[model samples]
Target: MELNYVISITDRDQIQELAALFQSLELNMGLAMLGKGTATSEQLSIYGLSNTEKAIVSTVADGESARQLFRAAKRKLFMDIPGNGIMLTVPIKSVGGGRTLAYLTGNKTPAGGAPDMNFEHELIIAVLNEGYSDAVMDAARTAGAGGGTVLHARGTGTKQAEKFFGVSLAEEKDILYIVATAQQKAAIMTAINKTTGAGTKAGAICFSLPVSQVIGLRKMDDN
Candidate 1:
C-alpha cells in the first residue's frame, strides 16, 4: 500500500477546517501544524516563506481509502480556494507494528504498506526558504547528502520579511527536504549557505532526524 502525504497549504486560521478535513478522511495529522507559522517573521520567507499563509501536513491511507479521501476533498474543498496547497503520495512498505501504522494513517484501513521499521540510513528534514532548492540540493550533493525531495511552496508574510541580511523579500517561496547521513549534515548545510547566505534567494534553515525505518527505495540503494 502507498501513503499520500498531503501538505495542505493554507493559513493558521484555516487549520481547524484542514484538521476537520483530515479527520473526515481518517488520516493521521503528522506534525499537523508548523510550530510558529502564524507570524511572518517566524514563517521563514527568504525562500518565499512569505507567500505561504500556513500549511497542514498529513498522511492518509492508500488504495480505496486513499481514492475516497481524494474524491471527497476535490468535491468538498479543493475548488476556487486561493493558496490551497498540493497533495502528493509516497509509498510506504511496512510499519513498526499494527498500532503504529494505524496511528500514522489515522486508522484508515491499511493496504498493509507502512514505512519499513528497519533501514540503514537516516532521513533528514530540511525546512528552508523556497526558490533556492537548486542551490540547496547542490550543497547537499557536495556534503555527502544521499539525495532529497524538493517541494515548491509559497512562503507567507508581507510585512515580516523586510530585510533578510539586507535584502528585500518576496511573497512566495520553495522548500527542499533532504534525507542524508548523520555524517553529511554539516557539509550539506554549508553548501546551501554558500549560495543562499546573504546575497541569494535560497537562504534556509536546516535540520535532520534519524530514520527509525523506511521502505521502497531501490533508487536510494544506488546512492
Candidate 2:
C-alpha cells in the first residue's frame, strides 16, 4: 500500500463543504489551516478572484483513495475550473513508528517498497518573516514561479533559532507554498535563498517536496 499526503486549498467559505467531502471519503483525520492567496491585485483580477482568504485542508490516503478524492473534488466543487481551488498529493516516503503508521493508514497492512520520486512538479515551501512574503514572492516570480499560497503561522524555538543563526528571529511567520515544474525548482529556490534567506531581513528558509500528482492548475498551465 502506498500512502500520500493530500492537500486542498480553497476559499474559506468552502470549508464546511470541503470537510463534508473529506468525510465522505473516510479521510476523517484531516486538518484545516487558514491561509491567504498571494496573487497580486492584477493577477487576481485576471483570474476573476475577489476573495483572498483561503482554507488549507490536508489528510492522508492511499494512492487509489487520493485519486478518488481528486476526482470527486473536481466534479462536485468545480475545482477544475480556474480560481476555484487547487489540490496536490505528496508521496509519503515513510512513517515514524509502527503504531503511528497504522493509525494514519487505518491499520492497513504496512506499506512496502519505496515511493516513486520521479516527478514533474515540486512543492516549494518557504518559511519567512511575516511581512516578507511579498518580497519573497517577487524573487520567486523572477525565477519562473507562477504564484503561491501564503499561510500565517508562528514560529517555535525562537530562542534556539536566534542563538543558532545569530540573528533576532521573529515569532510571527508566513509559509509560502509554490508549485513549480521540476525543471524550474532549483532556480526558484536559489532565487528565494539569495534574496530573502535567513541572513537577510526576511529570514527565510526554503525547501521543496516531491509532488506525485497535481490538479486544478489548468489556469496556470494555460498561461
Q: What are the RMSD figures for all models against the true structure?
A: 12.2, 2.0
Best model per lDDT: 2
Clashes of each: 22, 0
**TM per candidate:** 0.43, 0.91
Error of 1 at 145 (Å): 20
User: What lDDT score belongs to each candidate, Candidate 1 first?
Assistant: 0.52, 0.86
Off by over 4 Å in 1: 28-30, 35-52, 79-82, 104-223
Candidate 2 on 53-110: residue-level lDDT in tens?
A: 8899999988878888888898999898867888999998887899877777777786
**Candidate 2 overall lDDT versus native:** 0.86
lDDT of 1 at 51: 38
Tell me how candidate 1 scores on lDDT.
0.52
Can you write out model 1's per-residue Cα lDDT over 1-223, one digit (the tens) per residue? Answer: 5554444434456566656766776665544545222222432443344534445455546555556655665666662232243333444555689887678766767454455534344554554565556566666666665444455555554454555343333545555555444556667777776765545665565555444323322233544
